[model samples]
Target chain A: AQSVSQHNHHVILSEAASLELGCNYSYGGTVNLFWYVQYPGQHLQLLLKYFSGDPLVKGIKGFEAEFIKSKFSFNLRKPSVQWSDTAEYFCAVRSFMNRDDKIIFGKGTRLHILP
Target chain B: GAGVSQSPSNKVTEKGKDVELRCDPISGHTALYWYRQSLGQGLEFLIYFQGNSAPDKSGLPSDRFSAERTGGSVSTLTIQRTQQEDSAVYLCASSTRLGGLFFGEGSRLTVL
Candidate 1:
């Protein structure tokens, strides 16, 4: 079974600090990577996705992730975080085998930005 | 209506009782999915429905859990004789053939 791992369980940082969340997956085939953000009292929304081509993918809210195939990692990063950025971030992956679109999500990382 | 819609945003039921969670996927979506998100845990895939084909229920945790999609649209996930361990947020998502999933607010189920 394929799985995703998020290194950070809970992260607390002051506003304007840099943010980097680590994510790694266990799969050998071609996969689609994604980052989903769940704001307080909101649904899970797509932040970014990597299908093919460029390894570096930029998403909304100034978030970007790099897909390192060698490491089986797709880490999300933000240059400067804001107080509003406090939320739970999830890293997910979907394999292309047989065109099965079942997506697997990592145990999210809870981020709290203090003002 | 607009995005995926899940009914009963929060549901609290006694252990051993049955509970049903509803999901209304986006219009014209061909793929619907069910996932469970427990506290401090990652999203657990429950089932997947694509078009009129048989659903992929491989992810369902146990025989107590089952789901169905009607008319290729709305879906219902029913947990029979729910246990306390079944407490989690049940999320429904829909997508186009090759599009990113659009999720609902999710239905929080608390079994006590």
Candidate 2:
């Protein structure tokens, strides 16, 4: 069974601080990685995804993630954060070969950005 | 086409009752999915549908949970004899192949 793990359950940081959320998956096959964000009262939206390409992928809102195959990890990062960035972040993965693959999501990291 | 849409933004049902949650996927999208998110447990994949076929039911937590997609477009997830543990927000998402997914606002179910 494939699964994703988010190391930081909850993180609090002041504005302008750097942010990084750790994500690791348990799988030994071709995988598609993704990061989704949920605002205070909005639906889950795709931040970015990694199908096949460079290890580092930049997403909307100055967010980025690096896929490290050796470690089975895809960590999300943002050089500078804002209070509006306070939201829940989820990491998901699906096997590439599976045409109708079921995406497995991490428990999620709740980021609270202080003003 | 519009993104995925779910019915009954919120549902409150009594225990032992049956309830159906609906999901309308984007037009032309061949893939649809169902997931549940509890307060702190993150999102859990409940089912997946591709062109009216479900190749995987392994993610379903129990026999009480079942889902079906008709015409490869609309889907219904039914929970029989709902329990308090079944309380959570049911989310529906659709994809244009295996790419990024567009999600609905979700239907929050509360079983008492």
In order of appearance, the predictions have TM-scores of 0.96, 0.96
* Candidate 1 per-residue lDDT over residues A1-115, each given as its tens digit: 7889999999999999999999999986899999999988888999999999999999999999999999999999999999999999999998876767678899999999999
lDDT of 1 at A53: 99
lDDT of 1 by residue, B32-94 (tens): 999999889878899999898899898899999999999999999999999999999999999
List of chain B TM-scores, one per candidate:
0.98, 0.95
At residue B74, candidate 1 shows an lDDT of 96
Global lDDT of each model?
0.94, 0.91
Q: Score the docking of each candidate (DockQ).
A: 0.88, 0.87
List candidate 1 segments past 4 Å from native. Answer: none
DockQ for candidate 2, please give it.
0.87
What is the TM-score (0 to 1) of candidate 2? 0.96
At residue B29, candidate 2 shows an lDDT of 89
Interface RMSD, one decimal, each candidate:
0.8, 0.7
Candidate 2 chain B: worst-modelled 10 consecutive residues by lDDT: B50-59
**Whole-structure CA lDDT of model 1:** 0.94
